[model samples]
Target: MPHVTATKAMPVPASKAWEFVSNWGGTDKWIPGVGPVVVEGSGIGSLRSADLAPETGFPGRISERLETFDLHKMSFSYCVVGDNPIPITNYLARMSVKAISKDSCEVTWESTWDTELDEAELVVAFNGLYNLALDNVEQLMLSENQ
Candidate 1:
């Protein structure tokens, strides 16, 4: 199994960040080139699907299932379900936010998956995606506060 973790600092409180992150269906707001997400249920066990925007270079849809959610803890875990464009299987990932100060927080995304393909390449791709999404989150949150 290959594991990858990406973390970024945000100029917002953990609670503020969690408020945005907890909206599982609102991922498109912070994922650079993802279209609106369609959710099939509410809370844990629900499924969300979205198509990557053409400009993203990954022109395909992805479905993910919410595995665990904790509002108070500011954390959640999800797994890729159904068909995946990435050549990986058993993809499970978690996202969490931790307070760094009264006005700042750190966001971390980590995942482990099995793949027969080039692990290094996939790791780099996943890390890039995570960092990009986190960067988007920071920008959106900062703009919202300003």
Candidate 2:
């Protein structure tokens, strides 16, 4: 599993940041390549969906798909459903939040991707996506603060 983790100091309150990222569908707003995460059920076995990278113009988005969704846990673990757009064979994204202080919070986005891509190639791609999401969250929180 190719993995990447990113952390940023959000301007919004820890609870505020947790509310946004804890929702599965909200990922697209912060994570660059993420589409709207679709959820059907409620937990462990809940169904979810998204467009893979090929469906979009970006290469990384190809692995996006509806897998399992868990709202109560504030995290999502999914696999490639089928007919994804990218070269990824197996992929899983798990996002979590941790409070550091009254107004400070940390959101950790971790993903494992198995693709035809070489380790070096996937590393660069994963890093870019992770950083983009971190920057997006930072921007969103900052705007909310003001």
Candidate 3:
């Protein structure tokens, strides 16, 4: 299994960050290139499908299922269930937010997946994707505060 991790510190409280990221269905609000996400059910076991914008060059839909959700811990884990846009298998990702200070927090997003492609190649691609998403999160949070 190959893994990729992207971490970023955002100028937002942990509670505020959790309130947004843990929503699961609200990914489009912060995840760049992702369109509206449609979700079924609520909390753990919820299923979600989101489409990638055509301009992002990865135009397609991907579906995922929430596997673990922890509110107090400000973390969640999910598995890709169908229409995987990425070239990987047995994909599982965990995202968590940790309080850094009274007004800031760190978010870590990590994923492990099996792929036939060269590990180095996949890592670079996944790293870019995850980092872009994390960057968007910071931008969104800051903009909201302004």
On lDDT, the leading prediction is 1
Query: Deviation in angstroms for 58 in model 2?
Result: 4.0
Candidate 2 vs 3: which has more TM-score: 3
Tens-place lDDT digits, model 3, residues 24-62: 888988777889999999878889999988776668898
Question: Please, what are the lDDT tens digits per residue for candidate 1 over residues 1-146?
Answer: 89999999888999999998778899999887788899999889999999987776667898999999988788999999999766789999999999999999999989999999899988988889899898988888899877
In candidate 2, where is summed lDDT lowest over 10 consecutive residues? 55-64
RMSD of 2: 3.5
Identify the candidate with maximal TM-score: 1
Candidate with better TM-score, 1 vs 3: 1
RMSD of each: 1.3, 3.5, 1.4
Ranking by TM-score: 1, 3, 2
Identify the runs in model 3 with alpha carbons over 4 angstroms from their true place: 55-57
Model 1 per-residue lDDT at 146: 77
Q: Report lDDT (Cα) of residue 25, candidate 2.
A: 58
lDDT tens per residue, model 2, 98-127? 667777777777777787758778777777
List the lowest-lDDT window of 10 residues for candidate 1: 51-60
